[model samples]
Target: MDLKNLHVLQQLMDLSQDCFLVPGPVRMGQPCLNALSTPVMTARGPEFRDVMAHLNSGLRNAFNLAPSEPVRGVQSWSGDDDYKVVVVSGSGTAAMEMVIANRFRSNDLVLVPTNGKFGERVAEMCQRFCNVKHLKYEWGRAFDLYELERQLERGCYESLLICHNETSTGITQDAAAIAEMCARHNTSFILDGITSVGGMPVHPTEWKAEAVVVGAQKCTAGPSGIAAIAINSNFIERVHAIRDQGDSNPNYYLDLVAALKKGGDDQTPWTPAINLAMGWGAALDVLKNESNKVRWDRCETMANGVRNLFLDLGFELLADAEQRSSTVTSILYPEGIDDAWRARLKEEFNTQVIGAQDHLKGKMFRIGSMGETPISEMVEGCKRMIECFTQFGMELPKVDVESYFK
Candidate 1:
């Protein structure tokens, strides 16, 4: 319980190095970086605890729920009574697993439309739990909604899975359009918004999404660990009806009904990541402020800044500007440079940038402006990157950092 011992602190500090940039050349201009320096307490803060206490009282007063709701910080349904939200361990993957395990029996037909790495992971996860009918697409190409509709009309699936933002390739699907089509077809819809939520406009309730899964790290500006799902009442009822027929729930940890019945109070079936949750709570408080719109617009503005920087530097983006994700920007590495040179840039520059997944690995590198990353850091990161390119024997344009950052 004493998490402050020197050895423990050292380990935590080491982990923080990997999780955050501290007074380094890459620090983001956000208060979150400061929060990381403090000792993480196990319990909630006084203000957060008071809010939970009031929510607990409200739940009890309205729903007649037991004290269990307080433990998990579950609040009463104030907006729409037709849906339930559940928090879980892993990131968005956990929420997605919960929906896949609970909604369908083993070998039940489902449509999985994959465009990138996360989309492929969704299909893989679905296959692990059910018989998935994968509708695969090229990594950077847009999915054909008409083809999706045609496949659905062929009567082969009971559910459809879509990833709103394919982080691997900077492609965002038309989720609202897909949700509308699924609604018309009476097919269950599950959307993976791991990198889309909070950074972009996503209203799960209004979009008629059966299940919307989100992670804390990407758009929420939170530490990784906590993942959440918003489930409509109809989906909950469907799970109940399936269980009533004596089918086994494929996954116990991801069982939404059992989690909700705990009144949102108990610890997860598995031990929870407490410190990460604390960080997430702090991040969410920042997100709920009225200036959240400005924060999102800042992401858009920063993304545009990055895109324009790359284009001005004579490097092409991997995806179209309109379809690219506001959170991460993928750029095709300039021609004539091989993978070995790309690896050298990171070794020399002391900057971390992600390369493409699978076949696109040698062709592209991705830079993210997610969380509290400052636009200045990105502008400088690009300059260092260009310097590295020049050092690697690649011909590069002369970038005036003074004018660039201005």
Candidate 2:
């Protein structure tokens, strides 16, 4: 074998290597329809110059804060003035890691309530960086607050981490109740509000969250590169004391204290995604201008429409009707149907729906109504889904999908 072109080149030429870049099924924002695509129009010439001159001012104005504020105005308020917010390269994962590495000591026990994929990820994140004690819940199932409080009273944990909206299973936990429980136990509360910040109701300050994290991709209607974590003054002081004592923070890029000191005008610890920041600025402006109640009601109405359609189609929902997330819904697949039926639905109808993850995969599929989806479009998607089910030999009752729009 000519080693230069034999072993190495053979491996490089393998067919399996090419599979990585192959396009998967179309996603929510990147629907097949060109008209519905998320507009990423960049500023040009004078518009670009004007945006550049006043971008910082725009960000400050959006949050009703000063330009020199230590915290990034994009983050939700976490009930403290001293704490600083920092933007990171990764999404919610970056926010989680930053908080975990900065806040926890070697032996500090943290409580994680796992109800879905994101909640499980929170546990995994904690396990890697801190001593974790999981307070597990079944997927699609909401935890009882009384039981959670009792567990926290008995457990030796410094912080309790939860995913406010478990997008994986379409269940939204009560962050305020969870935070109150943590408060009673004198434990710090960390909430992953990645999917709930804008579309869903989440007031970190009122919820008693000591630290909160959100990503731009979900409810913010922004690009994915930017993430923010808001911390309480007490939490910041604790992290600052740890840093001052020469304790090594594991990740360099997500060091919030350092990022805050540098100010948002300067580059991030790494090169910032300038384009994403621009999109995020625009999206945040839209969110601020739009009434919160109106946006929330729209999501609620869409979710309910989907749920009603599922009922008419003779399918069971994974979560209780009241507890289901307004942003997404996970409905059980028809009994005795094979995966091929799902494939046919996608290929023939030009509609994209998500199958469940892990144990729930093949058992259920998730339908989401978020991020600029018109009510009429959602109704059409549901009607198509029903038709697909009928084509697969599962007879579905006709639904007044049009009435759902009203």
Instruction: Highest TM-score: give the candidate number.
Output: 2
- Model 1 Cα lDDT, one tens digit per residue, 1-406: 1335434634532322222211111232244445445564434344434333333332222211122333334443222345555566787788788888888878588899988889999999888877988889888688888999898887778889988888888877888888888888888888888777666666676677777777767776766666667677788888888888867456677776676665344334454455554555556556555244665676677677777777888888877556877777788977776566556545444456777888988898877766566666666566666766775576766766545434
Query: TM-scores of all models?
Result: 0.79, 0.80
* Residue 31 CA displacement from its true place in model 1, Å: 6.3
User: What is the TM-score (0 to 1) of candidate 1?
Assistant: 0.79
Collision pairs in model 1? 72-264, 72-265
Q: Where is model 1 more than 4 Å wrong at Cα? A: 1-78, 264-270, 338-347, 398-406
Instruction: State, as a TM-score between 0 and 1, how close model 2 is to the true structure.
Output: 0.80
Tens digits of lDDT, candidate 2, 1-406: 2456334634533322111100011122322133224354343333333333233333333322324322333332221243344566687788878888888877688888888998999999888877888878889888877778877988588899988888889998877778778888888898887777666777665656777777766765667666777666778888888788876457687887776564433334555555665566566555555645566777788888878767776788998666888888888877787556567556555567777788887888777766555676677676666666776677666668888667
Deviation of model 2 at 269, angstroms: 2.8
